[model samples]
Target: MKEIPKKNGFTTPPGYFEGLSERVLNKLEEKDTSALPSKEGFKIPEGYFDGLEEKIQDKTLQRETKVFTLKPFRPFLYAAAAIAVLVVLIIGLEKNNTSTPTFDDLAQAEITQYIESRDLELSSYELAEVLPVSELEIGDFMESSVDQDEILDYLEDSIDDLDELNIETHEEYQ
Candidate 1:
């Protein structure tokens, strides 16, 4: 297939550009001579500029603003800011300290639940090692319902030989 040649689609009058610059100049001259005023309408009053600087200075001096200096109170402001920061720090520290839970604050059931969930195998001797043994008294043990007979029965059933019990005397313990 043959490709057709492309042509511009725009057109103008035969003499449009013949005297374009002259026509524009003539129009500009007509507008300048007839449409626009010869001089601007603004007019200055007589002697207005003579004392203008003095009038401006008088007005400025009459409207003089009060100047404040922070130099006098700067130290007081710094001290107040420091005190505020210290108060906030002390209050924050107090709140944080109170937020921590203590051992005595824990419920017995909660402790038991935690131990059972972890499946800990802590023995009585291991528990005793952590206990405050110095606070215990003979009367504390005597408060138990178990009598001597029951204790002897338990020992007799559990032990096979007397030598197996490495019982210590008070003097030996001392």
Candidate 2:
């Protein structure tokens, strides 16, 4: 298939560029020089500038003689500043007084729910950092529920794993 050649689709007004400079010069020549006034046509009083310095000094003295006073809203500005300080103090104290939630503070149901939610992504060491176990704190764990015999039995069973870890660590150091 043969493609048609496309035109630019633009056109100029007749005589737009022709004799533009001559037309502009003729317009300039048409203005009359004599009819237009050259002077600014302003006149000053004879002694006006003579006491200008004294007049300015007199105005300055008038202003200086008046006493300066506070604006009507100045007290309100002080009140707002005081209120802002009070609000900051209140917020600061509230944050300071709030206690950190310990294991003892959490309910069994909430603790179970939190555990079941699978939200904790921590390793055992990281979880230990979060929940440090003191003797008293450990007593509170499992609702003070597990028997002493069961605890001893579990510890005895885990002692083998602990011994293996110690031997591995000793070999690594040597």
Candidate 3:
């Protein structure tokens, strides 16, 4: 068995490439010299170029301009904002106005217990000073339900000598 050598099957004649470029140029020149019109039937109308700039400007100016505004919705927006504020205020007031206990609502025993538990260092004079003088009346103190015997007993137990007591009478005021 013999091995065949690989060879290109296509071949060109001698000097084919050397004359290729010259042949192509000659064909182009022949086409150029033929009796065909250069414009190939496409023609621009007269005065078309003269008015092109003005025509473009006129077309641009004739286009309607788009305008956007919030003017129509201004009142609605303001109303919505005001409604939001009112709603917020209403909710806030509802929360704040919930039934909070006032000093008058507390029982006397509860008030006394609270004062005793806190061990406040304030004296009776200091407590009296804090009370508004305008609100106090002689009946407020005199109207207490304590028995006169109990008062005498408490005073006797608290005081060693009656001579030290500075009792004031209504006659002394005159």
Best by TM-score: 3
Higher-lDDT candidate of 2 and 3:
3
Model 1: CA > 4 A from native: 1-24, 62-174
59: Cα error in model 3, Å:
2.9
List model 2 lDDT by residue over 53-141, tens digit each: 99898877856456788666678888999999999999999999898779788886897688769977778788677664564465565
Per-residue alpha-carbon lDDT of candidate 1 for residues 61-99, written as tens digits (9 for 90 to 100): 867579987656468888999999999999999888977
The lDDT values for all models are 0.78, 0.75, 0.78
Worst 10 residues of 2 by lDDT: 165-174
Model 1: lDDT equals: 0.78
lDDT of 3 by residue, 1-174 (tens): 887768878888998899799998898887866575666687788988998999899978867778787557468888999999999999999999899889779875786688889979999999778756797666666657776567666877899975578754244322
Taking every candidate in turn, the Cα RMSD to the unseen true structure, in Å, is 16.2, 16.2, 20.1
* Candidate 2 ranges with C-alpha deviation above 4 Å: 1-31, 62-143, 146-174
Give the Å error, residue 64, model 1. Answer: 8.0
